[model samples]
Target: MYTIKYRVPESARSGQSARSEEKWYHVSILTQYTCTSTGASNKKRLHRKQYCIATTKSSQLENLRSEFGLPVVMDPIGNGNCQFAAVSYHLRQYGIHRSEETLRQEVVTFLRQTPVLGNRICGANWWTSILKQPRNNLSRMSTEYEYGDQITLQAMSQLNNMQILIVSTRNSATTLISPDGSSCLSSRYPLIILGHYPEGAGEHYVALGYKRHALERIVDKSAQVTWETDPPTSDDDLNVGGDDLSAGGDNLSAGGDDLNAGGDNLSAGGDDLSAGDDDLSAGGDDLNAGGDDLSAGGDDLNAGGDDLSAGGDDLNAGGDYLSAGGDDLSAGGDDLNAGGDDLSAGGDELSAGGDDLNAGGDDLSAGGDDLNAGGDDLSAGGDDLSAGGDDLNAGNYDLSAGGDDLNADGDDLNACDLGSPNTSDITRLREMVQFKRNRKHVHQNRHVILPREIWCIIVDIVLKLSPLSRYSLQRVNRMFRDLVGKTPPPRLYLCPSRFGDVTVSPISVRKIIALSGSGSGLVQAIRQLIRHSSWVNAWLFLRLATLCGWYTVEGIWYRRKRRN
Candidate 1:
């Protein structure tokens, strides 16, 4: 129902003729009311074209060509002949015998005779205008499709019982859609459409670069192909695809994929086999494999939980109190036992021995603390090995690898000398006194260091630095934010003078502490420094003191008044 027109500027039309811009006038859509066989209730959308008086130049349609990425040709079939030309172009490609002029005349005939077109039917001139046409030419012209519209195309399609896909182009922003409905129509099956121009000016249409049917994919439905996932699941027969073996019941066999629920004692020899909690046996290379007396062997084997005993090359006895035997093994749950060359028992009260063995939990006793009695690399993380609450004692050359209290009593074979000097019977008593005197210094400073030694050291260094230096260090990271926060400000002098006598004032200490950001403790240190000290120049201190905010005008006034 909406009408869109495009007209170019007069500047671009300087040397252009009427048909010059026709290359840009692509497709115009018009609607006509029609009735169906069941009744007038059924309505259908139709495509139509009108003889647009204005023309559009090719330069104005460059955007359309760039977007669609195809060559464009203006309509050469004159006014009112677009539908016939468009339909004839498609029919000839499909080897249909049809002329463009003949189709145009037929489209005109279909529109004039259509009952729904009513009094304003297309190609039917007024009674007064019809008198000017010659007698024979009047009949052909009335049905000659002076201008083709949507209803004209519909009637032709209904008569031939063929459906056609048409594309209408309006502007540069518009995207060309494919016959399949979502994509651009293949260039092989080219269609005509309107191009870019100013509104209500000139209308233009262009032919696309290719044909539509030539780009369609031809599919053959008669060929037969086999799929691997559809393998048969006969009893004891392996499934080809290895997925969803058998849903009927248990004891159903499948190869390649994992197994779901099945019968008791069902044996699965697949690559990655799995079974329900109920009793089941798997002899697969990997994955879970178990039975009542399950024997599993592979790189990684997991005998599912329960009172099931597993004996294989590699067995992981994950069940409670379950016994497992393999070269490399791991066992979980309480009271679970395992016997292997290299064993790891996780439960409490586990007794295991091997070259590399680990026994966790309380009361885990081994013959010599480690599997290899005198071998290196022995680690026991559990508490209370051997005698309950005693240090876990390993034999000579073997260490209690876990916590220091490997044995509950904190006693171990690796005893450290607690600075107790061992003196021979022949040694003199005087020499021992000398050694004790030297060791006294160590005990005296033992309480000097805080528990957090590293943090205290970094804080002391940061606090001793100058104010500017401390400021730079404080911004290094968030961790040191408070380290330099209480640091004292820089002082005018670094060392005291030796020639002149130095004196300390309570008021100066208070003033310096307030300005230096140092606490009252700094005053005590300053007092101790200047108590017996001497400065090289006494006047230097007085002059620097005033500049350093040590002396104020009020203090000077009070001193002069006291002197007066």
Candidate 2:
């Protein structure tokens, strides 16, 4: 028998008390073990509070509020229990695809598709099959989960401990499931369309984010821009996008817009300079656009490769307007540019297969709606797999929309870019923040504390930044002393400087701002920033000729102050 236990951080609790920072009883995960059953063997207990229709339940919950001090109290019952299949699954590790995200997204996709497996087993049960284990070669961390094992049946039998928030159900007419066998997820996940069931073949699980037998879409010519760049970054992302579309709402997207295969350590998206190399590498594989308008999208500029990214040996590294709107939209479809990266499209409505494959061979294009069964897609978010379509046996890079039969190649892996500062980027951010925090601990108060030499290198990395973000980072620690003036980065002198550019002054700042805000949309954007800024009161006082009485007096006063 095996088990998995996780203590939710106190920081994760939703209660008003310190509970927020102390969540211990997180989800119970049965990892590490997978057993087959002929008769009862290695029995285990599963526990969690269950809720049912009852007002008295709230009172009971409130009473226990002091017992655990949890914010959202369980009602009616406390600690409901259930059982599972006799086996723990092949709890062994298998070298999954290079990117860990592939495995992560795969598991998430499977979970999202068939979220619940509720069936009950009895006092006695037996089985002899342990089909696909999580582990292939054999190691820990790889186990298998069977649909209806007597163990799971028995587990579900303890009604008081289990709760199935049914995303979908079988035999809905009869509310409660009371079979001592298997009740595979009966409904279809979003975008997935399953055929009718055979007499008694039980439920078949699929990590399908795309609908089955869905019709291929035909897009218009105008939308078919050969390939361009897009650079739309939000000044504040967390606060801009729609609230309901967050991780909580529509909790189950086609299961992905993101995927990660194990191994290749997707720590970085760059080809020559993978993010894994230097957490601070500037070699951008996946272009950062902030979803802004055409400044620079993921369309990795290569000599030729088309479809997803232009060129690069990473996934989801190209395309200008990839959206996670639908699995149909190209997400990370440009990562493996086999053409040279991975470019697997397979989004809904927007099915444009393998166009930007870094093929430098041809101006690779998935031609709008060019339906190639399992072909690459130049479209979709989290779908970039820039490589040219390799053989299915060899892990094909890009697989555009499926066919009328809707059956994804069993072994294929489709990656989805995890949004901004991708997972690896997040790790980098955390590292930077920690570095600053640590520097503070070592260097307390002093007239001038010299940040470690390493910090000097770190600060230099960000010198190109505008005062806006730089100012924010400076306040992070006393280590920022040498950054601005004191210990000016020697690299500052290395920056491209010219004698003729001595004109760059506060007035130049105003002119640049004004010029950018003129006739073009670029100028308007700057104006918007200035108008909305409630912080800096600084502005250029453009003094025109004194018009009349008031103007003449104001001009005279301005001249006095200027002279002083």
Candidate 3:
């Protein structure tokens, strides 16, 4: 048997004083025992104790109000269709009044049409089960009673092209599902806010409404919260204390020292004992040992030990060794040793038992021979040798002794080397330079080029001539070819050759010219050609024209005869 304890606040309990302290309650749970083959019993028990706080529905509603700024919650019918009912009621506020049954049917239809999206939003098994059916009226009617969840809300958001904010009363937090999977809510689309409240028997959803500017403030807060916090986990245990901690302050530390360390550590000394100031001795002198030890002294004795001896000196044993003493032994101010037999004396003196050693104030000598120590000659066994000076010589031979000698020798060598220039090369170079200078000016200037409009007019006149002439004109130039190609061919009127033999005719040349000028020449020509093209029509036309002409002539001749 195991026992668990809970402390319920007096304000949270019914019919209790609001200012009263909390009271503890105990509950017991029995463990199951299984018998093994050896006749021994093993007891199965829970490893860790889990505590939960249950709030009243009114308190939960108040939390939803404070967090989401939704003071009004319209409860829907809890007939397993509360999700759709809540969504329908929310849409009704925006003048899109849809019934719960209509929204359910729309969701089903959307899922059926887009199976891929349905499978992604809802699980594959759920989608496959929805697809499989005697999908008749009976299956659909059965689905109408099925409860909806976040999957249904996602489908509704995508189907209606809107955003859904699920203000959960359990956690006092808002969950925003956008069509584009972003943290922001698109202002162009309507926002549907739904409240999820826990009921005694089951969970129910209600439509929530906000005040005038409360919606914008809540949305901005939600976006800020979404970015500032880690994504909530799926486990109920992990999400349990999130609301409690977030409601406290901006960070975990703001929950006070109790929740900061006691909640997770559960020790008496808290985090102070584990890794605080006391554990590492960071607040005291334990690590440093003492003040005067290990680099604590004023003169940095470990690095630069100033006074290792009695007289505030350095590395000295006898008479002020390695100090600023005059005429001291090893390293002193004036002399290296007494008796003037110093190994390295400061002033001018003999050294290494010679007149001068390595380098004297005035001269330097090795083996009683003066080296190049001053402004004088250096000799090795009687010969004056100079390595570098105004004059330099080696073994009585001058080698680049003077700067003027080098310059004069170079000038004489140049005078003996070269002769003259080539005249033909000079002439060719001058010609090349002149050709490059005149290249930009080499272009022909034409003074007589006709304008494009004049050329177009001339081409138009030529096109009105015979077909053979138009064809010959097209072969003139590229411009003429293009212009003739662009211009439409002149209308041709063909009539019977016999029609031309008739001297007088119904249609005269002046009539044809008048029709062409009126832009109906094509129609009139076609009509006349059709009238006189066949043999019968041509013969009839000819007979008519000749009879008319002959009658007129006879009338004139008869009048003349009568007068005579």
Query: What tens digits encode model 2's per-residue C-alpha lDDT throughout 274-364?
Result: 1122222112543222222221243443323333332323333345444342223333543322232333434322233432212212233
lDDT of 1 by residue, 244-358 (tens): 2332224433332444533222223211133442334344432243223333442223323322324433332443333344332233422222232333344433433322222
Better of 1 and 2 by TM-score: 1
Question: Which stretches of candidate 2 lie above 4 Å from their native place?
Answer: 1-55, 73-309, 312-564
lDDT of model 2, residue 51: 37
* Ranking of candidates on lDDT, top first: 3, 1, 2
lDDT of 1: 0.35
How many clashing pairs per prediction, in order? 40, 140, 0
Please give the distance, in angstroms, between residue 477's alpha carbon in candidate 3 and its true position after superposition. Answer: 94
Deviation of model 2 at 60, angstroms: 1.3
Per-candidate local distance difference test: 0.35, 0.26, 0.42
Ranking of all candidate structures by their TM-score, best first? 3, 1, 2
Residue 171, candidate 3: alpha-carbon lDDT: 44
Query: Per-residue lDDT for 423-458 in model 3, tens only?
Result: 223233323323432442242223457755457557
Show the lowest summed lDDT stretch of 10 residues, model 3.
Answer: 550-559
